[model samples]
Target: DTAVSQTPKYLVTQMGNDKSIKCEQNLGHDTMYWYKQDSKKFLKIMFSYNNKELIINETVPNRFSPKSPDKAHLNLHINSLELGDSAVYFCASSQQGSETQYFGPGTRLLVL
Candidate 1:
């Protein structure tokens, strides 16, 4: 069974469009995170949630939002998407206090 999963593994949209990526983890981890990898392949964490509470908020545009409905789920919603938003978004989960994380197959987003 997949420990972590994301919907719409691929997405293509125009600039100014709104999009959302959904993530779920079956690992029973208490912490979940959203990371983005740009075309340059630099990975950075955008948001982190622990026990359904926001824990870390990286310096990202306000257009980006992370929502956690429960411990096992974290979703990313982007508003007014721009060309810079084209990248691979990854969802990961780990136990509290653990550095190890299990990542879902990334969602590739392309904004033209």
Candidate 2:
């Protein structure tokens, strides 16, 4: 069984557009997170939610929003996309009080 999954492995869009990527987990984890890896291969945390409660917020733009329907699902919505937004978005999940995490394949976003 897949522990974590994200939709639309590849995405291409023009500037000023809006898009969304969905994530789901089946590992019965309580904490889900969104991470962005830039072209330089630097990983940074965008947001994290545990039990549907917002817990971590990094230096992300206002146009980016993270929504969690439940503990097993976390989705990201991006608006007014810009070239700077082009990056690999990864979804991850972890158990409560656990340091280990499982990551999804990742969604590649390209703003043309």
Candidate 2: misplaced stretches above 4 Å?
A: none
Per-residue lDDT tens digits of candidate 2, residues 1-112? Answer: 8789999899999999999999999999999999999999999999999999999999899999999988999999999999999999999999989999999999999999
- Model 1 spans with C-alpha error above 4 angstroms: none
lDDT by residue (33-83, candidate 1, tens digit) is 999999999989999999999999999999998899999999999999999
Q: Where does the lowest 10-residue lDDT sum fall in candidate 2? A: 1-10
Error of 1 at 52 (Å): 0.6
